[model samples]
Target: MDTLITLIRWSIATYCLYFLLNNYISYFYGISLNDYYQWFMLPSKQAEIEKLPLIFSMILFLLSVVFLNLLLSSIQLKAFGNFETYIYLGNSSLYDAHYIKDGDSKVIVSQTATITYNSSFKNIGLTQNFVSNSSVTDGLGKPQSAISMGNLFASLVITFFFFIPMLGPVHALLSPMLAETYTAKGLNVFKYQWNDSFNALLALKGFSLAKWALSWVAILVLMIYCTFRFPLQQFGKRAMNLPSYIAANQLIEAVPVSIKPIYIERARKPGETQYFKRIETSRRNVTFRFDKDFAQSVYVTAIVDTENNNLIEDKITSHINSHGKMQLKITDDLGIQLVKY
Candidate 1:
């Protein structure tokens, strides 16, 4: 799964790079997408008539693709690495625990459950409650803390160079080498480029139909590579096993569990009745049973101790008037099985 996801990400990144490069060329050289197509399709006689300029443009496009890919790969690695770290930390006890001094409690356990449903009147409402003990963190060492004004400024400067017409590709090619100097000095050169504002701007600058199609094709190829290279394995294995480990030690009588509806789509038909039962959890698995009348699809998430304590999450689509039972099996070897009956 990780491999597949990585491939998808790379594929998307590749297309995005191509799109940006194409747009940059169009904006600077007044060349259209059709012009590129024609250049490749033109007969030898026609090509010979304009050989010099055609060769130059082709060379420029190829160079841009290579440079852009380098820059994009770095950005993708950093961005996805940070996201994976956040997921790991968020679900771990290190980030969710409450340090109680001199208290009999061996570990702080927090549980919360939330339910959301739309009424027959077409109004959506939510109910959430927390039970048992829970505490907030000092907010230190979070991923967000990595972002700073200096990083923002640096990102803006690097990104600005990419839009400077003829000079952009040169900078894109050289920027990684330049960034290595800072990296050797224990600095995060690409961290600044993760800014949301900068990403939005980049997306706006590169939006194009040809780019989208190219990106999709890239995604398909990457997906195939990742599927074979990376096998399906449970993500956050240690964290997922914490409950069973604590259970085995007999340090805690029960793992604090929470089941929440993270998202709920509208009912398929107006005034359709929707039914949901409280989700149940145990050391071995989490179970969700829905009644035949359920009308909307819901994305349900389960947590062991806190809201950030994600154990398993699955999307449940409504099949009206059909009884549904879904179970997520948990094992000590970090093996996961989703059974639907």
Candidate 2:
């Protein structure tokens, strides 16, 4: 039994080490079969067999945990005991003073004595001696083989019945995003020459270099697809529909303000110059924008009617001037703009 247990423990450890190495080496360039299948194939596959890698990975992880627990239990049994239990006493006086006399005490015989230092101390003068046993017991009541096998079978059943059903959404809904992100990052690594020494760090033998590179690409692709389906596609749709939601929230009586005399001219630099004549009006509220990019500062001034003449004051705030793209909204007393820089 001990020999068999040692073998199982060694096997489980070996399996875990290899699993870790495979996962690590496979993702060195940030991609894999799991990623490719998840991003490209899993979303399209209507069959379970096509989605086996993810499901198998989950099952293997679960089995590893169970095997680890068995291995730990065996080690604990060797150090401590096979089965262990302790009778907890309500009071220490009853357990320590009279019930448990001294050395090699095995059992405690007591009628329950309450100990209270603040109020009163009641001693039932517990009649029998308390004893402690160090002998090991098989908590599972079976050989290590039987217990290990039983747990392995239970875990397998759980994987099929519970985990398999949830694998599809997890793969379809999550993997694409991660796949895309990793793939982009890996490609960017080559572009920016970031982590340039990554290849040199790994001493690739035979066909491993190509295999590793391909694996990383596969993983990245899967992550990209997952992200796209769950967040990116939805984000694009929501962003495109935001204008309608904003329009619906406004009052119908709100007057439409037009930006006048808009002219766009190219600048000497990359960005262009936008020229427009500001509409001088007596109203305190007004909005303005340029059809083309503005290379220099533009000004909007409010013309207020005074005693006899119009008093012109700069209505532009520092907030609107600091952006590359802006939509200014001037409400009676408030100035707001939708800006992108």
Per-residue error for 307 in candidate 1, Å, reads 23
lDDT of 1 by residue, 73-180 (tens): 434443543321111211112113121112122322222111121111111112111111112232212122122233333333333233333332332332333345
Across 118-194, the per-residue lDDT of candidate 2 in tens digits comes to 11111121122111114323111222322233443443343233222333333333343443564565633222221
Per-prediction RMSD in angstroms? Answer: 20.8, 30.1
**Pairing residues by index, what is the TM-score of model 2?**
0.21
* Count of backbone clashes, every candidate in sequence: 0, 29
Worst 10 residues of 1 by lDDT: 118-127
Off by over 4 Å in 2: 1-50, 82-178, 186-341
Error of 2 at 270 (Å): 77
Q: Quantify how close model 2 is to the true structure by its C-alpha RMSD in Å.
A: 30.1
Cα error, residue 281 of model 2, in Å, equals: 99
